[model samples]
Target: SVTGNRVAHTANIDRIAARGATFHRHFTPNQICSPSRATMATGLYPRHHGLWRNGVALDGRLPNLWQALSLAGYATKGVGKLHFQPLLAPVERDMPESLAYWERPGCEDWHGPYFGFDAVDLVMGEANEATRAGHYAAWLKRNHPEVVDLYEPDANPDSRAQDLNEVWKSAVPPELHYTS
Candidate 1:
């Protein structure tokens, strides 16, 4: 974890922690991203938030921290992988966080107000090429089309041969990485 005492190569994360706050005794409502993030936003357990698992959407009607902050006259913005909704659900569901919505006709114009955020700049998933879908992808396509194709899994054929099946080095250069 980024907050681990002996963790290395997390200077940026550490700086943020220093500037604000870090939890020493953290308790999570769910193990996964969506449910956990929802818990943080709504200050409610998964059952109360109506998002018990990954693919389920959080009920928009529920009061959340972002909305509360907005109502309190703060501008709320989200960046990167919010994961508040399914990244691969059907497009008809109107899940703006999903790749389906990001691939639509005018998705490039979408910046947010989504799920109580006044504005958002989203990236749907991790650095994996297959899941590269959102504003970041659009920016990459527009500005670095030459290397975008290299992000595909097959671009680095040896990536899948690692001892840990889920571990693979991406062919996308560090300079072009989502976190870059």
Candidate 2:
């Protein structure tokens, strides 16, 4: 997410923020992504929402923004890293976001209606080079199979950031990225 105060590098985000509103003083009950997002979606604290950590699922029974909007006749679609459920759960758990589920026989047709989303195009993590699963992975495999190997962090043999194990400049073009 682009910070409101740091808009210089994010011209597109700045333009969107200019038309609406941007918050500078934001408070979060949970510091982690899943719990914090669950808080925002459910309007409840992490304890109440039942997503205390990253590898847990947010209680689907809880009221959420998507459910509210859907009830009001708005079709809700989620794209990218919506970590409502564990991304590495067991295959038997049937977690749509998990790599285990993606390896299953009939998982190809599964696209949507999860976590109050009428449709979804999900990615597990920000770095598609490493966490290659979900809709983005499928799309990449089907459309850009040749480029798939280039997405690996170490694919760029000249990259200095490879040893850092945190960040790296991917050989894949920016337009091919999941976030793009």
Candidate 1, residues 35-84: lDDT per residue as tens digits?
99999999998888889998888889989899989999999998878888
For each candidate, the alpha-carbon lDDT, in order, equals 0.78, 0.78
Kindly provide the TM-score of model 2 when superposed on the true structure, using C-alpha atoms: 0.83
lDDT of 2 at 162: 32
Clashing pairs in 1: none
Candidate 1: Cα lDDT at 80:
79
Q: In model 1, what lDDT does residue 106 have? A: 88
RMSD of 1: 3.5
lDDT of 1 at 153: 56
Error of 2 at 57 (Å): 1.0
**Model 2 spans > 4 angstroms off:** 1-22, 129-131, 162-164
lDDT of 2: 0.78
lDDT of 1 at 135: 84
Q: What is the lDDT of residue 95 in candidate 2?
A: 83
